[model samples]
Target: MSIGVEEAYETAGMILFHNFDIRAVTLGVNLKDLIHPEAEKMCAAVEERLTRLGTRLVRQAQAVSGELGVPIINKRISITPAAWLIEPCPSPQAPLLLAQAINRAALAADVDFVGGFGALMHKASTQADRRLLESLPEALSRTQRLCAFANLASTSAGMNMDAVNQVARLLKEMAAASPDALACAKFVAFANAPEDNPFMAGAFHGPGEADACLNVGISGPGVVRAVVDKYPDCDLTMLSEIIRRTVFKITRAGEMVGRKLASLLGVSFGVVDISLAPTTAIGDSVGMILHGMGLERPGAPGTTAALALLIDAVKRGGAFASGNVGGLSGTFIPVSEDTAMIEAVECGALSLEKLEAMTAVCSVGLDMFAVPGDTPAHALAGIIADELAIGMVNNKTTGVRVIPAPGRQPGDCVDFGGLLGKAPVMRVSRFSGSNFVGRGGRMPAPIGALRN
Candidate 1:
């Protein structure tokens, strides 16, 4: 499958001018075998395995990027969920020790982030799960490269309100423990979290996955926005077609790079996550793409409908381009990571409620946004529950990566710098959801979960 001259030229143009890049090439390394009864021994084993694999991942990704002329912006690692590994450890602080080991491995390998430092408590929490939850604030705050996620809900098992409530409190503690709540940016709460998602904070080497595999995340919000801008007068249907074609090209490029990289590394090729992930850079925003579709701005009237169209079109195109399309293969609307979304929040065009609404149609949920420090933990749980409920009923993946920025109020800004970007503290409802959130038990799965 060689690239044609015309296709090659177009791809070059998109790369040169439209901020198109391979956002991440995450090597999912299963560390379930590294679990040992002794915490020290287990930590050494985990570090060794990750360092060996992560080094290969970065080298292969760099080689592939240089050969293809596409920028592979991040080389990351995702290991088996920490809960599984921590269950065998004797020490109370085993989770933190493991997190430190993971961070050391990432730094040694020169990877950007290493994920899977949390648990899956959708149905019930085990003793190890509890310990991992308890250790999250300290572990995340202390580690730079370690990212964490907890699957608090799923369509089959239902929402774990107890786990959700616990995480809410931990999130506040995590913010207070760190400067600017930076650790909160490394954590995410998910419903139906995917096993092979290459994107950070939620990615993990699921128990079902192979020992080692490579997954690629391709991002091109700027490219999509450019195409939409080129056809300004087109109808909605025409606009969708244009976006679909553009995404097809992008996904094909991703598939080529992923296959080549995996081959070079002697690992199985997993999937190409064709998510239009945006950055803080100008013209590289999903919100700007929405604005280009004539919504006046993101969070304006008809924004959800426009986003739904874009999401569906991108998925369709990506699926056609590669059968390996998986993960959250849709538009990402992270508030802080996208310049246009940040601007919208700053100017009051985008509200927390509206962003929640957009998440119902987009890939992830309530991502990278901040709220007032004094906002109750139960309120954060309420927000997470609402977002996950959408995924539960719709049978799709949804997540929350919001931060309760310390000492920040509505209209205030917290700067995270670099790709984490800056966020304006958005206002939450003054009303309380404590009584509702206090009713801690499993929220039953939707009727759709009975499909099997």
Candidate 2:
């Protein structure tokens, strides 16, 4: 099916229209204020600040969107950790109470998702952190818009085998909670979590972040795929170079849009996350590009090699364009949101096993994917634990945001709606890991962790 010159030119035009992105710029805000003894006052303060902030986020995002033409996907807010907030409150019930407060404030702000609600126990989970972490089941189950994250490990601190053990158990409990526990999709366990990265559920307003700085998220998988499609016969080296040049240009556009948006919003400018994000739209897929690159299957054989090359090239290129290149800079392969990845599952080209394997070399782990509804909670915990282990050992940032669509069987199409997109229920192994995941203890930080 060789494309004629005219069709190639026309397709190129379409790709450029959608794919030429300086993706998105996001702002992370700290909300240590939300835990005051005067909960009412604290909540009111957050709501007011968020309202004022939303005006800036929306106005600036729209301005940037108008100028860039490539859609800035979301205008989100990430707050200072709920764990820290809960720690000072001195009550196990504090997390749930504060979560409700934050949830309301987020809604009032006209934002999409609000992040940072769990713990950071890379080595130790304080009594407060554990209480907050344990409360996630209730919080996510109770709130529709709040996103949660637990930083279980980091490159400098090594892995928190203990927290991993708890997270595994938490998933099992959450799954049993029925409809709400599935909200775990809003939760992520991160390794090497960055303070300024704008995406969620990992994005958190670190202590270093200003009260309200505007961070940016930039994605252009469609753009990169178009460039690759243009040179179908080119070798790996040539392909890499082309992608580098294109990403450099795209990131420059991102920096320009981000700075302008932040200035208009009257906030300090933050880092640009140069991740190869995707959408449900066709032609904006990393897996599809890999398929187009003659891989035959996206998660088989030379898949990791291709992914390693792709991620490295994207970083090398994006870093060149922006001195502020800082968010989740690696590529993402969240299943449902990525049309090509969903197709691969339908066609039997990608499996959960292979997807986790691919995560070993790339950014995040199995995300927004669907597995058999019959997938036991223990199995789900196992699923998340395994992926986090890869991040733990490899010393990278990896996470799992899997969806077990209630009662959906393998190959069944489940629509999560909105930005979550649709997913074909992927087959999960029938085996059990209950005994292993049930072992609740910490995985000590690896020995190589000297830098923080």
Candidate 3:
């Protein structure tokens, strides 16, 4: 993966000028083999594995980042779904204990975050799944670095209204338990969620993966926005081509760094998620990219079309650059994380409905948005159901990470600071959807699921 002199210079320019960097280097460690009938023994095994591997991951990741001159922002670990590991434990408190153990390991290893405190019950819930799900409010509120997710729907299995209803209620409880509802940020509800995602709150090592693997999430929102700024007068077709070419170079650089890091760590190199994840840094924004493409602001009249074009070009470029592109490799529209998106919400240009419409094309549905705490659980369920239905019918991965900020009304602001950024709380509808969401049953797979 040697680079020519010109290519090296261009890569350096991207890092030095634009905000091109590897957003996350996530090591997926399977803990299924460490499962024990005794929760204490299981916790010990899991902690030992994570502490050992996580230390090495942090050490070597820094070495690679220094060597390649690429900034790796986050070093994380994702484990086998917690539900499977806790299946054999008889103790009702096992989930909280496991979360504490994982958090201890994360602190010892010095990683930014550890994912996989979650369950997969898109169609049906097991007793273990219920236990894990029930403990999320306490487990997440008590732990610092542990992220959780629940997959409640899929293209083949359809939507689980029962799970959706339960999660909605739990989200409210989680909000009430944690300050500013920050615990809700650590949890996501997914439909058709990916197994090898390197992002937080949604990353988990799937049952089918190898015992150990290293995955990367590369973000270049600034780089793409810079390229878009260069061609002000170009037509949309040519603009797409330009963005695609730029993303190809970004993906190549990510693949080089990821492969080198994996080799150094003696683990299998997994995929490079070429998602345009934005940050609070000035000029590093997916929303600004739309603005550069002639939109006055995100959520403007042509915002959805603009996002679709941006994401399509990004995926095509990533696919052309590497065969190992996986995860939610598209544009992220987190309202808090992106400066322009936050401005849009504050200015009333972006509504909750418009964001939901945008998520049909973007990755990670309804991400990092804040709402009023008094919003009913039924309304939350309605929102989750609507978002998941898009994924189920469209057969793409989608997720929701909404925060119900206690005592914060619409138009007020909540700042979690650093990476999570500041959010201007948006208004949710006062109307209720309890009658529709209360009828607990599967939504049945869409007609497209019959493809066989």
Candidate 4:
């Protein structure tokens, strides 16, 4: 019952395990220096900067991760929002050129995704932003490591009707270009965005951020699920207290790793995102945690309430442990990534409907999970729209990162190989959202939106 933050985590550190720590530390680098108005020079400058930055990040991260025994997962980099870089591009060709440079640079440095091929026009869209919007389909499709995004709304300005409509249109086109439309999953629309979030296909270098910053996203679902499983009959209050203590220990571990890595790299420490992130490993399922809490299954009647309690306790603990706990610091229920969740789905314990409801409390929705290949794009967008609206009205952060597994039907599994995880194609509602999704205006931001 101690209220002390550091002390509580220090005490809990004795039993920290299943939350086996690893972080995806992303470095956001501003690219204004790479823009030269002349396409040739601009392209060269970009390559130089990205190559240098990537090399530096990877080398430093190697030293740090090796020292800490916690893998740095990705030495990825996010650039200044591409909309700013292309504000004066006379041709769509320039964006393609710029994006290619970014992608190659990431590959050259052995990184997975190079983010910030995006536009931020929650309030207004300029012609350049519009052109980048136009070019995104080709940019993401053609570039191997490049990711695209657009910030369409924010709490301060309400939702942007024009941007939302445009993104919906973009989603349809992107879906046609790629069956997975995963390129669109790479494109995020944010509300009340943060300056330093180390995860992507959504992370971008916000305008208000430093020239470059390092944000860390730590993953530890198995650790937590194991802790909860040890106490099958603990009531909600005791459950919350137990979870708070465990998460605080995990957060301290993350802070230790982040600060040490940042110091070795000679960059100021940014924020530690204590997100209950999962991998494609067994024992890493949020659903499994619920099941261990004695839920006969994850998506049953009491699922939402259990999830809400889990979320509140996680935040309360994480907020106290880290002076700067940011990013999507909530539980992730991505079906395919966590082994337990996939089993829950295969066992008829979790459903698409239940997963959608879970997004109301979790960090992201349908993240990298496979859906029936036959699922209509509008229906997909409609599903995404519903989850986003939950965050919009409720004034919390929510996102959808679904992948309609190309040519994969239900009961079939699509393997993304790494952290993207393999998922059995989940069934979708056999319905159409062509009419609903077509009404692409803002769902007027809800009344009494001030919750924080």
Candidate 5:
């Protein structure tokens, strides 16, 4: 990965002054080879492997961050899907024990989050997959650093309404077991989920991947917003060109850092996900980028078009930067994590329905938004089904990370603090989808999937 000298100097300025940083450097370690029939030994071996790899991951990430004078905000680890490892051991306690072991390993290594603690049931759930689903509420409620995901739908296999309904009830259970429904923040439901994504709550080492590798997620909504703000009167074509140029710089920086870190750790370099993920900080917002693009606020009349243009420009820039770009390489519009999005919801400029439409174009689906506590499980399933359908039909990766805040009503706010941030409870449709969701069968894949 090579960068021009002038481009490097400009990127360094963005890092030194602007709020540009590598969001995460995730080590994907395959646990398939370590599976054991003895539950006790399996758990111990998993813990030991994670602890050893995670510690080196953190140390090397920090060293790289210091060397480059750019901050790497998080060092994370993702393992093979827990259900695959737990299948060999039929013990009922296997899921919980494995989750506990993962939590311990994350803590021991001082890593922020450990992912891939769930299963893939895009078509159907096996006995072990069902067991893992049943244990999720307890496992997520008990563990702090462990994150989980379930890919209930995909373009090829269509939607698994049964697993979708199951995840809804499990999320409700997890919310009831935790204060402020924090556990729900750690879970994601996906359609067309990526195996090598380095982002949290959705990353996993796919069965087809190598033994171990390194992937990077780079974020710079602030940097892009700053550039867009500077060219206030630029035309739409010029605006896109500006965004593409800025994102190219961001992706190049990520490529450089990811390669250096992978070399130091003696692991193959995976991909750089140049997603413009936002935070609670004021300037760091994908919504603000849209605001700069001439939208008064997100979810306004032209919000979807703005987001589509932004995502397209970002992807083009990333492709220009590196051939290895993978993952959900576009703009992420998680409501709670972006101040502009939170304000949009508070002011009624954004609605759940509008967010569903936006998901058709954005990188991920209805992420980090909260709905009413009284929202029924089938209603949650309805929401998931709608979002997943978008991904399945469009052939893109989309996910839902919604929280049902306990005892909260529409307009009520739940403060999760830190990176999870605060979210205003958004209103859901009063009409129930129980009847539709109760029709528990696979929704067939779209015609698009038949291509090739």
Candidate 6:
């Protein structure tokens, strides 16, 4: 985490001119030790622990941000998946109760978000998981700060079509319960989900991690794009080298900030997630980076090739910069959060089909996009199944955060404001894959999974 003088100067320039910032400093806290047989007792224990730790995390993250002159956008907390803690409770309300407690603690502590209201159901689910899944509509629609995720597929365990089906049905219910379908924005479905992701709504303290750790998610799409803009006339290979170098510096700066914050909080420092997450600010966009790489816009022909090159260079640079790089450390194309992406959809340059093709090369899939409200539950299931299959077969982490904007039509828009940003409603195919995804069975692991 040592920052040389030269690197410091470069990072200062990045911060001052290019919107380089730490997107989130998420403190992952293991809650396995706090589980209790009674729902009230368990909820009480979680509330007490999270309130104290979350307060400290928010305070220290602010201090570190000011002390280093770097912006830390969101102070967040990730806990052990809530379903495991409620396994002993017989009450059907256990999940909702726990979610309320966590939400209260997050509000008390003044953190931006609290993630891990989720379960690992890549293959199958327990009774507790089923109970939690059923309560998602209530929990997500009711809580402002609590985020939820379900790992429905993985390379080794294959795809959990049953859980996928359940989540798709729950999503529609969640949309019905919340305005603008905002509840769906807080819930993501994943395949090969990362254990230590610092980004929501998919972050959780994996069962294998330490009791507490601090993970940092870095953002520098603007900085990288600025660098890419300078190499317009250069060939793709050289452009990649330059982008790689810029990300190397960005990752190093993020590691320095993360390690200092972790030390201040008296927790172990986890990985630096070098994902180029974008925002609505001008020039702060992964899609703009692609445009700078010579695409007319994202979703144009050759856009996938440009994205593939960009992400590969990003990974190589981050891996070179630090040994502790983890999470989904690649490019994020969340349509709502990136202005260029939103424009691409508005101009009809980006379609759902093209976005799907791009996801095969990017970090996550179908993030923060919107579709018409009348999209059938089975159609949503078909969409999730398609993305999850990409991750399952490719052995990469992919997720979906789609909003079925209730009563909205294609070409309409929904504004969630702040970092959730605005999204244009994209058209969904009228053709249904109901019979295909309705087959409730596991899609078997790939031949690559049999390597072990």
Report the C-alpha lDDT of model 4 over 288-361, residue by residue, as the tens digit. 78887778877778898888898888888888999979877877777767777777778877888888788777
lDDT of 3 by residue, 82-128 (tens): 99999999998899999999999999999989999999999999999
lDDT of 1 by residue, 206-304 (tens): 988999999999999999999998888899999989999999988998999999999998999999999889998889999889889998889898999
RMSD of 4: 4.0
lDDT of each: 0.92, 0.76, 0.94, 0.73, 0.92, 0.93
Distance (Å) between predicted and true CA of 231, model 3? 0.8
lDDT (10s digit) by residue, model 6, range 281-377: 9899999999999999899999999999999999989999999999889688999999999999999999999999999999788899999999999
Tell me the alpha-carbon RMSD of every candidate.
1.3, 4.3, 1.3, 4.0, 1.7, 1.7
> Which candidate model has the greater lDDT, 1 or 6?
6
Ranking by lDDT: 3, 6, 5, 1, 2, 4
- For model 4, the local distance difference test gives 0.73
Model 5 local distance difference test score:
0.92
Candidate 5: tens digits of C-alpha lDDT, residues 76-139: 9988999999998978999999999999999999999999998999999999899998898889
Q: Tell how far residue 422 is off in model 1, in angstroms.
A: 0.5
Collision count for each candidate, in order: 0, 12, 0, 2, 0, 0
> What ranges in model 5 sit over 4 Å off?
1-9
Better of 1 and 2 by lDDT: 1
Compared with the true structure, the alpha-carbon lDDT of candidate 3 equals 0.94
| Better-scoring candidate (lDDT), 1 or 3 | 3
lDDT of 2: 0.76
Could you give candidate 2's per-residue lDDT for residues 334-367 as a string of tens digits? Answer: 8888887888889998888988889898887777
**Which of 1 and 2 is ahead in TM-score?**
1
Write down the TM-score for model 1: 0.98
